[model samples]
Target: MAFVIEKPTLKDIAQMRALVSDEVKRGVILERSEEEMANAIRSYHIVRDGGEIVGFCALYVYSSSLGELRSLIVKESHRGRGIASALIESIKIEARDLGLEEVLVLTYRERLFQKLGFVIIDKTLLPNHKIWADCIKCKHFPICDEIALIAKI
Candidate 1:
């Protein structure tokens, strides 16, 4: 099957929320409320197989020079079909369009990001703003076990 990666619309919010919720339950990604998804809808890119949203990812810009790749999830049935890589590539283009210098991610899938040109970095090297704005709210917080990776855009 072919997949298209493109910006999501308001109508896509519910399906996007459902996808994230499934990953959240599996402890693979963070949970996001519908309102949160709606507010950041412009930041998201989704993979559609016909009319169904099978995968999605978001680029959360922190500053003109930095953005974080977040909430990347490909349905289990759709894994290994290059959807995730395509989504990341789409985000890289968006980051460049916004004049961002780099993109970062906190992930357990370090090898996957590495293949996409991201290098492992010490989590502490991340900005205090990121920590204060989002990390603090994460259940893991100061004890986060996710690996940090960065890629130049």
Candidate 2:
């Protein structure tokens, strides 16, 4: 069956939250509340396979010129099916449509981002304070090892 990519809606909150929670448990992604996802539902893109949410991602616009890719997660059974890439492309299109000049991502999967045309950069180089606000929730806030990468659109 073909997967469908579309923006999330209120009804998707439970599934979205569960998917994120599962990822967090696996230590592969950060945790986000259902309320948070509901409020930011417009910024998310999800992949559904047979009506089940198998992949998810969000594009956070911090400024007119800057955006961040956050909470990219694909179901373990759905990896290697191009769902993640599809979600990333959807975010990139939204970023470009919003007139963003650059997009940043903090990810352990450097090679994946690199292959997608993202270049590694120093985390300190990002001057957005709001972006760092989320860092406080991270266990490794003071010593994050996730590589920061940017792709100019």
The number of the candidate with the highest TM-score is 1
lDDT of 2 at 85: 83
Q: Which whole-number lDDT from 0 to 100 does residue 106 have in model 2?
A: 91
* Candidate 2 vs. true structure, TM-score: 0.93
Candidate 1's residue-wise lDDT over 78-147, tens digit each?
8999999999888999999999999999898999999999999998889889888777767776788999
Q: Could you tell me every candidate's TM-score relative to the true structure?
A: 0.94, 0.93
Candidate 1 local distance difference test against the native: 0.89
List residue ranges in candidate 2 displaced over 4 A: 1-3, 128-131
**Per-structure clash totals for the candidates:** 0, 0
| Candidate 2: residue pairs that collide | none
Highest lDDT, which number?
1
Full-model lDDT, candidate 2: 0.85
lDDT of 2 by residue, 27-128 (tens): 567787777788898999999887899899999988889999999999889999888888888888899999999999999989888888899999888765
